[model samples]
Structure formats: structure tokens, C-alpha cells
Target: MQERPPFKTLFAVPLHCEGCISSVTNALSQVEGILSVECHLEHQLVEVEGTAAPSKISKSLQDIGKDCILRGSGNANSAAVCILETHAPNVENPVRGLARLVQAGPEFTIFDISLKGLQPGIYQASIRQNGDISNGAASTGGVWEEDTRGTEARGRLGQIEVDSEGSGGIILDISVAIWELIGRSMVLSPGTELFRQDDEATLVGVIARSAGIWENDKVVCSCSGKTVWEERVEQTGKGML
Candidate 1:
């Protein structure tokens, strides 16, 4: 059988100058499965073409002190993206990821989740509301719903199976409005096995909900009244679009 072509992904990172671009391009080119790396400094974007796992690419850039947010696979319309992070203090192996929501129809959305640094196995993922965990609280229990008390599964996102390299991706069909999902979070937890055990450690970290959906041609920044793309375009110009 013939090998498949490498996939491409865009990352919104901190790229300020030619030096930064060269550094990121060189660093990504060294990754084993990466086929090409293009840095758009004006837009602070790094476009990577590769068969390597998405998480691996994100981690490599992060390891070199370049924080990045996955911006989807070259498509920049009507999408919301989040950077998933670990909140556990004592855990050694940390989980990191990117969750993207794309409008599929009137009332349905597709969730594209890519994660790294997880144990190789099956895991359950769900969308959770921001509960009573006050903002000033020391720890919000990492936002994983503890029991069935007030937590009801809104949409069955999908199952993610991490490979031996601790990287995985899954597409979830969500039956909800994009507007309804803005401030809520996504959580990855152990499968039903954890339900039987009284262990709090079964909880995984909360996904850092970042951008909201773009309605029509407008950028949906509830606070600033400007969309993220609009701000990027204003600073970087139409070339980014």
C-alpha cells in the first residue's frame, strides 16, 4: 500500500521577527515526521505539514519556550479553539491539548480534540459548565465533575485512545449551539472504571477555553466587541486571512 501524505496544522504562537521564525522553522524541521514548516511572523502563525502527531508538534515548540495554540487544519472560519492544560499540582505526567469546535449545522457542532502526555488507553471526554468553583478559589478541583449530583452529560463528545507515544485525536459530534459552549469547558476522564472507585485522582485537567465562535463575518469578542481574527487582521493584514 502507498503511504499517506502528511497532514497540515496551523498554530497561533509568539512569532515576532525573522529570528523567531527561523528558530521555529528549524526546530520543527528537526522533528522526525514533520515534512515542512512555514512561519508567518506577521500573524504569529506557524504552519506545519507533517504526519507526526499534533500533540508532539505542540510539545516540541513548547519545550523550546514557544507557547502556541492550535488554530485548526488551515481552515479559519467559524471555529472556536482552546488550549488544554493540567491543573494537578503533584502529578508527574501532565496532560496538554487543543480542542476546536466547528459549526456543522444549525444546532450541531464538531469537536476536534488533539492531546498529548496521557497514558496509552481509552478515555472519556465531556463538555462541562463552569460550576460553583469560584474564580478566587485556590484550586477548582481542576473542573472535572466529581459525581452524578449536579453533573449531567450534555453531549457525548467521543472516546480518545492514546497510542504508545501518548498522543491521540478524536472528532466528537456535539448537538449544541456554538453560543452555548463559549465559557464552558471540556474534560477528559478515566472510563467507567473510575466510577466504581472512590478516587478523586480519576479527574483529568480542564481544557482552557479560549476563543468563541465567529458569527457571520464578525469576530466574537464579547468583551472587546471584536473577533480574534479581526484583531489579527488589523495587526497583520489580509495576508493572514
Candidate 2:
């Protein structure tokens, strides 16, 4: 197989709005080989991808009066990366829970996560993998993705599996938190390693266990924002309506 291209992610200063994205974009445009820049408004996270050097990226941003946090570094082909944010009111309660998600998939693939299921002050993160697992860490963002000081960690979850088959299956019932208001979802990183009968199962449906992706088929029901990762991926695979 062809080797995957190396990719690095970093967190820039807390941006207040799209204007901030424009600000960083305008400032960083002075650099070269910046393949793409995704500034998530919901997560308050800025992902810059390209041939640009991390140090240079840092220097330029710093010169422009912005700080950056490198989330992770790996080849995009091999590493699927996603971030979990839990910004509950009494956010402290969910800190440890969110950290667990980061530990679950250190070399996490950027899968679709939403926060609709999350309560105002409760937070958790879930990661799905199907091969050798890796450790991960948290930058300075909230567990459910918000502007605040948070923790970073690194470890491994068993692997990514959305469902199970014969012998291997989920070890425990996992919790999913979401917010209908913002169209965000958080897959709770397991408190311990989980097992599934199959490896190809999508994390959303399988991880939810016999009950399915949601307790009662409840999903982040929103028509405004983009369809979530699960819906989009499924629709694409099935050629949906």
C-alpha cells in the first residue's frame, strides 16, 4: 500500500467567530503549501493541514499575535482523527469523562461526533477503532469542544468497531451525549476496554449495543447544519435518498 501523507493538527488562539477564522486565514495566507485550514466554529478549534513546517506555522501565527496548540501528528492515510468536546455548565464533572475519550483512541481517526445527547453540564467522548490501538492527548479545549482551559492525555482504546457479531461484542453499555441546540455529538470514551464480535461495525450503532445508536432511535434532529458523520457516511455507502 502507498504510504499515507503525514498530517499535523494544532489549536490556535480561541476565536470568537467566523471573523476569527478569516483573521487567521488572512494572516496565514502569507505562508505556502497550506493544503487546507478548517476552523470549527462549534469546537473553537482550528486544524491547519499542509506542507508548512510546524515551527514555522507556530512562528507565523505567533507573529500574527496568535498561539497554537498541536493536537497530533501522523500520516492522514493511517491515522483517522476526531476530537471530543464537552462544555457542560458545571464542566468540571465531565472533565474526567472527556479525558477518557482522548485516552480511548490516541491515534484516533477523525470520525463524526456530536454533542446533542450531552446535558448542560455532563460530558463524555467515544472513539471507534478496528485495528491496533494507539494513545492520544487533549489540548487546551473543553471536553465537548468549547473555549476554555482543559486537559490533554494519551493512551489506547481496544480498537474501533461500530457493531459486533459472533464472540467479540461490546463489554459495557456506553453513553452518548449530544446537544440539539448546537448540532454536536460526543462518543463517550469507554471507562475500560470494550470488545465486539465484529470489527467492521460502525461505532455509532454498535457501540450503542442492542438498543441501537440511540436509546430509542433518538438522533441529533437538526436540519440546519451539515448531517453528522454517521448519517453522511451511511448515506454515501448506501446511496441514500
Candidate 3:
């Protein structure tokens, strides 16, 4: 009889539709240490079962494009499982992530902007006000646009050049939350394009092989004899392939 650690921090959120849920699920599943996930569209609450810290969870959720807020936690009489492994892709230089911008559509345009001086790796790709929200993320790569939407409207926003003067900015390992477009940049809308790499933005990630493992876990209440099983998730290799 093994006692599992308690799960914590449930997140309740509001997504536009079932498509939104699918997008969120796909994004979060890429996280390395997540244990369980229950996304209920009826209540708009995504119950993520993991043993990681809340800050870590919050960052991960943001990376995947979730407007997540804490709700509650329960010590359910359930079986808990944990996994640990490494994986890589089959590409020369593989990024650690592969996100599809599930917002931008086929007609989203990436125009240059200039309120002043702009830098590479970081630029604001203006979003057309009259574009479809389903277009997905707007970036210079094909990864986000593929999983998020497709390769119909792949384009660049702006390039980024890292400053090496020492006072470097903080970097996030969003290699998991591949992106596309959403809300309008100059304007505001649901389908508006959301991601941008302005001059101030720094690119900090490595392309490598991705490898992961799948674990079959079940929760059985040692006291009540009730069981919670049939849970699974796919660990993907990012970057290389």
C-alpha cells in the first residue's frame, strides 16, 4: 500500500470554446513533470495535478497561452504517479518546444512597426484588425504555425539580437509553449495576434533532441478501496525533429 503525495492548486479559466480546451491541453501536456490534468469545459476549470511549485506551474501555464488563475485543491483519495526522463528529436538543431498558434488564420499579415528604434529577434508584428482569430501565432518559424494552425500564413514579426553587455534579461524556457497569433496587436480582439519579438526581446533557448516517456498510473484509495486509474499523457521530444 503506497501513499501518494497530495496534489495541489486547481486552475479555473474561461476559454472561447472546445477548440480552446484542445489548444490548452495540447500545450500543457508538453510540460515535463505534469502528473494529471482534468479540463472541464462546463466549469471552465482546468485541474492540473502536479507536485511542482505553484510559481513553476503558473509560468508553465502562461507559456502555453492560458489565462490561468488559482481556484482550489483537494486531497482526493486517488492514486498518484510521477515520471522522469529525457528525449530528443531527429533534427540538426532542435528547439525544446513545438507550439501551434491556434488563433491567427490565413490572412494575418506581419507588417513592420516604428515608434522608434527596433531590434532583431524582437519586433512587434502588427495584427490586422480584420483578420480571423483562428490564424494562430505570428512568428518567424514554422513550428508554432503548424501545431497551432498550419503553414498557410507563415511569416515573421521582427528579429532579435541579444545584448552581451552583461545586464542580460531573464529568459523563459518556452520551448514547450510554441506560439502563433491571437488578439490584434494595435487593436484588441479574441483572434488578435498575441506574440511578438520586439528589439528588447532576447532569444534564449537551445535546439536539441527531445525524448520522453509514458507512464501508466492508477489511484486506489487504500482505505475506501475506490480506485482512480486510466490516466496517461505523451512525453514529446522537442527541438531536433
Candidate 4:
């Protein structure tokens, strides 16, 4: 397997003094894929550089009694995101998963995907040619074609097994560019086959550009007048991972 290159990710952490910085640094050092950790006490921010999944980094901080919100990741114009949702009839909450994509190197992009409220089975993830989700996954076109690597189907992102709790995730690098994925769509389907039109279990979402490292620094939402942590609490209550 090719080693994944390290990428930078910024987090909004609550830091007050040198002790807080030490605690945060020490906690991150224990996480297996982290290459380095930098804390900015004045901004209450932590910059992590490595192959560690953002979710794992956040969990590590949570374990140390410090909550963190990912502010940005990767380099400028090298990050994107997608929120997978189900459009099945009568579904109260459509959101079922999230995908974070970052260009870690010139040859590939890293994908950190998580799914919840799904059946216990294997799910196939793929990038589609179209971003349409009006009729759910059915509306999204076929797998994106990689002209440079003809017949290779670079869009196929392999599979993730959902556990009994309907949760599954995978973190790995794919041979695709972040710019190429923006405005496209990602679909998660049950089983080894690509998504079928009738499969209600299918989750689909459009990929959108996300902030790169240091691109976003606001600690509060101007529209909601809520701090990052406050917004995080609300989002957590809504089943955001």
C-alpha cells in the first residue's frame, strides 16, 4: 500500500493557558497517525498535521475533556465535503452520513467518510458524474469516468461494513483531485453492486468546497450569534459526527 502523505487540519479548541496547550499537545501525541501538533493559545486553535482522521483527532481531544470543531483542512483549494442523506418516504431525519475529502498530495485525495442509521451490511461508496439528488440516488448519473485512467473506475471507493449499530466509516486516499470532485455527488449503496434505483437504503449527497487550512478562523457564527462550541452542541444533538 502506498503511504498517505500528511495534511494539515485546523481545529477550534478551548485553550486558556500553557497548561491547556500542554494537555492538548500531549493528548494528540498519543494518536497513532499524527505527525505533529501545534497549539495557538491566543486563538484557542490547534493545528494538526498528519494522516489521522479528523474524527479520530476530535475524539482524542474529547477524551481529554476538550471539545474541538474542525475549522479547516488541507491546503488552499484542496478541501471539500459532502453530507449524505436519504430521501425515502416518511423518513424523519434524512442525514445519514458525512464525507470529508482533502487533497493530501498531487496524486490523490484523502476521504474520511462516516455513516449512521444504516442496516448492518456492506455498503459501496462511489462518486457519480452528476450532483442531482432530486430523486435520490436514482437521479445521480453513473460512476464518474477517469479519462486519464481509462476503464479503471476511479470513482469506486471500495466498501465499508456497517456494524450492528448502523455505523461505519473508512479513511483512505483515492486517486482523484479535490477540484474534480466538487459539484459531483457521492452515493452509498447496500451490497457490492452500485446503487439501484429502488434501494431505499441508498444515501446520496452533493460535494461542496470546504475551507482549507487557515481559510476559516471565525470562532462564532455571525448569523446565529453562537460560538463554535455552542453550534457544535446543537449539531451534535442532531446526530452530526
Q: Estimate each model's TM-score.
A: 0.47, 0.30, 0.29, 0.93
Mind sharing the TM-score for model 2? Answer: 0.30
On TM-score, who's better, 1 or 2?
1
Per-residue alpha-carbon lDDT of candidate 4 for residues 19-127, written as tens digits (9 for 90 to 100): 9999999999999989999999888899999999898998899999998888999999999999998778877777889999989988689899988999999998989
**On TM-score, who's better, 1 or 3?**
1
Among these predictions, the greatest TM-score belongs to 4
Model 4 C-alpha lDDT versus the unseen true structure: 0.88
Worst 10 contiguous positions by lDDT, candidate 2: 95-104
Cα-based lDDT at residue 20, candidate 3: 80
Q: Per-residue lDDT tens digits of candidate 1, residues 1-241?
A: 2233355677778877888888898889888878888887776777787555556777799888987656664233435665554445555543356676655455555566777766677877656554222321123333223444333445335568878897778756556556676655555665642221212223333333333212222326677777565576553332111
- Candidate 3 residue lDDT tens string, 110-142: 121111111213222222322222222223233
Q: What global local distance difference test value does model 3 have?
A: 0.33
Residues forming the 10-long window of minimal summed lDDT in candidate 1 = 193-202
lDDT of 2 by residue, 39-156 (tens): 7766556677654545455557778777554444333222222323233233332221111111112323222222222223221233332211221222211223122322222111
Cα deviation in Å at residue 31, candidate 3?
1.9
Off by over 4 Å in 3: 1-6, 74-241
Give Cα-based local distance difference scores for all models. Answer: 0.57, 0.35, 0.33, 0.88
